[model samples]
Target: MINFTLDQWYGWINAFLWPFARLLAMFSVAPVFGESTAPSIPKVGLAAVIAMVVAPTLPPFPALATSSYEGLLVLAQQVFIGMALGFVIRICFSAVQTAGDFVGLQMGLSLATLYDPSTHSNTEVLARLFNILAMLVFLVFNGHLLMLDVLIRSFTALPIGHASLNPAAWMGLAELGGKIFSSGLLLALPLIAALLTLNISLGILNRAAPQLSAFSVGFPIMLISGVLLLTVVLPHTPSYLNEFYQEMLGHMARIADTFAAPRGGAN
Candidate 1:
């Protein structure tokens, strides 16, 4: 029978535990992997499997007792880093959903919402539809694999440590939140402009002849027009989403670099 010293056992545990913590935290929030309908067992199992694969490759990390204060801090840092990375990617999806919200509102479909199990909230039909399409695109493009690649690279970019993260890194993350509106607005602008023009034309017609009942016909017109526009727009989305994912991947790299830099130092 093989025997191991206490230190050897601790080394083995440390090798797996830290990486597992980070992967588990990431999978808890990252898109596709984080879906609520997915059972937690698989997420945990996947995290474990990845940690095992990654542990041997990790650079030598500080060996501290798991119960030690510094060890706890390191664990927390891993969790925070993982969550930040996941949140940045999640923002990409949020932008797409926001664009759908804009188009749905313009098409008078804002009220047509359904219970979204993934989000655990009532979501507009168009918004949900867009999210589904985006998910499909993400899968088709192997985005999930890319995301995992980024996560693995982050370990090298921001190694396991007790280093105090720069405040600027957190600030940068907060600022990144603005992408939801800016990107969303851009994506939805074409549809919004078309629908707005339709609404304006209907309003002018109603003013010219009240008997035309433009108000009565406007809903159907907007709905049908919106559907037609989506058919045109949907085909073009993969390219935009590809660019969007690339941009977020850049952000993830920056974040990891920033977090690894010493506090108050240039990253």
Candidate 2:
């Protein structure tokens, strides 16, 4: 049997535990990995596997005993940092879904909804479709790998338990809330403009001919127009989404920077 002191055992445990906490928090909130339909065993197992892989590169944890108050604080900090990172990614996907919802509404498909098992909520059909497209692009282009890269770089950028999340960082996260709307609106604008014009023309026609059934005529036009408009938009999503993905991750890096240790500072 190998001789190991209590401190040695604790150090070994610390090496794994802290990274695992952060990875678990990340997967709990990160896109794709966080979906409710994702099996818990695999998710946790993946986090554990990654934590093990990254463990050797981690800066040394504080010398304080694992059971100490400081250790608990460090654990919490890891969770917060992981969550902050994951939330940024989640926002990007949400924006895509929002854009789809806007298009669906314009197409008079608002009533066509589906149960989203991932969120335990009802989402418009087109919104789900857009989300699936966005997700596929994310996977095809290895965007999720980029997210993992960010998480790994974060250990260097933010370090383990080196700094506390401040009010400003939290505020920065809140700002992403508005970003969802702006980006979503940008994606949906062309379709919206087209549909709005169609609706207005239909309205004038209805006024000119009272016998014209605007409901019957308007619905078909909007349906066909929406489908055509989406076809135009869908092909371009990958490029636009790529730009948005980079922008979102860039913000996350900056957030990590806020917590970075001063150059050459003692661990």
Give the alpha-carbon lDDT of every model.
0.90, 0.87
Candidate 1 C-alpha lDDT tens digits along 122-217: 999999998998899889999889999999998998888746777788888999999999999999999999999999999999999989998679
Looking at model 2, residue 74 earns an lDDT score of: 87
Pairing residues by index, what is the TM-score of model 1?
A: 0.97
CA lDDT, candidate 1, residue 182: 99
Kindly state the number of residue pairs that clash in model 1. 0
Residue 151 C-alpha lDDT in model 1: 93
For candidate 2, the lDDT comes to 0.87
- RMSD (Cα, Å) for all candidates, in order, is 1.2, 3.0
lDDT of predicted model 1: 0.90
Assess candidate 2 and give its TM-score to the true structure.
Answer: 0.94
